[model samples]
Target: MPRRLIIDLMRASCDVPFVSLARTLNIRPLLEARGAAASPPGFAAVFVKAFALVARDEPTLRTLYVKWPWPAFYELPRNIAMVATARVEDGEPCVLPQRVGDPDRLTLAEVDAIIRWGKEAPADQVPAFRKMLLTTRLPWPLRRLAWWVGLSFGRQRANWFGNFAVTGVSAYGGGELHALSPGPYILSFDVAKPDGTIGAMIRWDHRVTDAALIARTFARLEEVLNGEIAAEIRASRASEPKPVRAIGA
Candidate 1:
């Protein structure tokens, strides 16, 4: 087959139903309710933590589909990763801490430490620093290549990789939302409102996960945010001892 023709064929075969499914399910009310009760940490950390927890709890969210010889196939595993662009020192574009696997266990201080170090590191060393900070397995070259391929194919063929992609728009305030091209995972969270309320909008890839499942997940997240999880976070923070300094010695 001709190269263009092959690409067209693949594109045509790509799943598109996920977009429709995502549109039908709304996540605003659920997230707003949760935000009203408990405070989620800073945007970067909260998203990193939430993605880890959600992916761990919902294995289906971590699945991906790749072409096979006999027949096309889907593979499931705990292989989800979170990517975000961070602003370092004014307007510079620096990628900070692309954490892989479960980040839920990481304390707020730990997350801050990683981000702080990433920002302070020299520009040339940034990539290496991020890789070391995030994953122990994947080499920098492979990770970069994989991300590039994923972005290229994901934009062309929606169902090629994992089930979802979450984007944090908190830095942009409450007005804008991010959308992933041709994938089931589309999510955005607003800045905390004066009343400590915010909207969590998820535009899913309908082909992979159904609207009902997404809605249920959003509802569950709200429950976690409002219930014991919030309390636990508060207690955990409260237990930490405050630093005391002796008077001028």
Candidate 2:
């Protein structure tokens, strides 16, 4: 069964706009195909790579919006960082691999390696992962207190921890096309369809990014995915053929 903790956390604080964005992307068919595949590693790698490439091309895609009483601000970053939670065994607690970035630069082999490593990391790391997972474990009042503390020190320390958060549902048979939540920084994508068509849903912090900027970023990403990146992948595959051994006389 899914963790009750996670479920409750989501119920209490779920972003309805984010969910709506997912629904708009129309990723069901793609997710269905992915789920049916015997091996999904390649697909997952491709999706991650695509996201990375898109982020690279459109730096704003990696940014977050921060709202202040007077005005809102934007934060620009170089990479799209995300977290992945993996369960090592049935009924075992999930371990989170934090801040996997630049998925586009990683080859399928590399992605597979990382997944393997993430799942098998030392037991000691598990506790840290759990802590991150249970960040919502704090009572609402305590959470507010921490946020206040974080904000109080952030200006002087140049650290703003709650800039943004992104969660991936593709691994769970959720359809292609990522979704973003409106915040300092939040984005998600649905699984890709078998036909190579993808829908991208973006939620931006209105305070930081206007609709025009978000649209521009999305358009650039579409071009990258459908044009150069897609072409490159196809070319790479086409250049390689299965090797056969010659029969000895």
Candidate 3:
């Protein structure tokens, strides 16, 4: 007899989002130059930094349609970063959203480290890891309740889900256009092409902003990723100690 699949809270919560859109970006130069650049922090870190810069420049998109207490929109001052990752928890694989605070001020390396550590280290050491764990551990009914509450209010929304998200797929080679996301904006990119280019898409909230603003943000994101982020990665890589072979001792 076939086994019955046990439903998990994580899988259930993902279905709560009401709406999402799709966009794409080709970042060949940025990808090609990443390894050649000093201290490249990988695509995820660079992407998070790029999003932070763009969000800083254009804060209007940060506003959220909150429907709690009274209908009101809330604008967050700084971005709290979150990257969606599949984590092994208690012998089962679960998708957990890792948090990165004050991403705007963090360099590519710092952001990269936070994400790397989150992936490699114990869940207890990671910030907000427990919250996700607890949420999933909640009684099935409560899990749905919490998600509905979080997704409904503006202030509560930012507290649960960050201002922006980056779901990095550069390491794995494939092209996917849209990613289902909860934040106001998210970046989903494909693996860099052999020629050193990438395809990125932004799925934004149409409730607060339109396609024009998102298009512009996507443009600025590319500029910052290729310019400032690329430079920093290159500089960092230059400072690393090079491996040396001992002359036939």
TM-scores of all predicted structures: 0.60, 0.58, 0.82
Error of 1 at 76 (Å): 4.0
Which of the numbered candidates is closest to the native, going by highest lDDT?
3
Cα lDDT tens digits for candidate 1, 1-249 = 122222332453355444422222233443443344334345555544555566567755654433332223243444343444454534544343233333456664465444444446553466534333343234657745544454344321222333444456567555556444334455566665655466676665454566777777776665555453455456655665667988996
- RMSD list, candidates in order: 8.5, 6.3, 4.2
User: What TM-score would candidate 3 get against the native?
Assistant: 0.82
**Prediction 1 global C-alpha lDDT:** 0.48
List candidate 1 stretches off by more than 4 Å.
1-40, 68-75, 88-97, 111-120, 123-164, 181-184, 243-249
In angstroms, the error of model 2 at 191 is 4.6
Candidate 2, residue 54: Cα displacement in angstroms equals: 2.9
Candidate-wise lDDT, in order:
0.48, 0.47, 0.70
Q: How far is 75's C-alpha from truth in model 1 (Å)?
A: 4.2
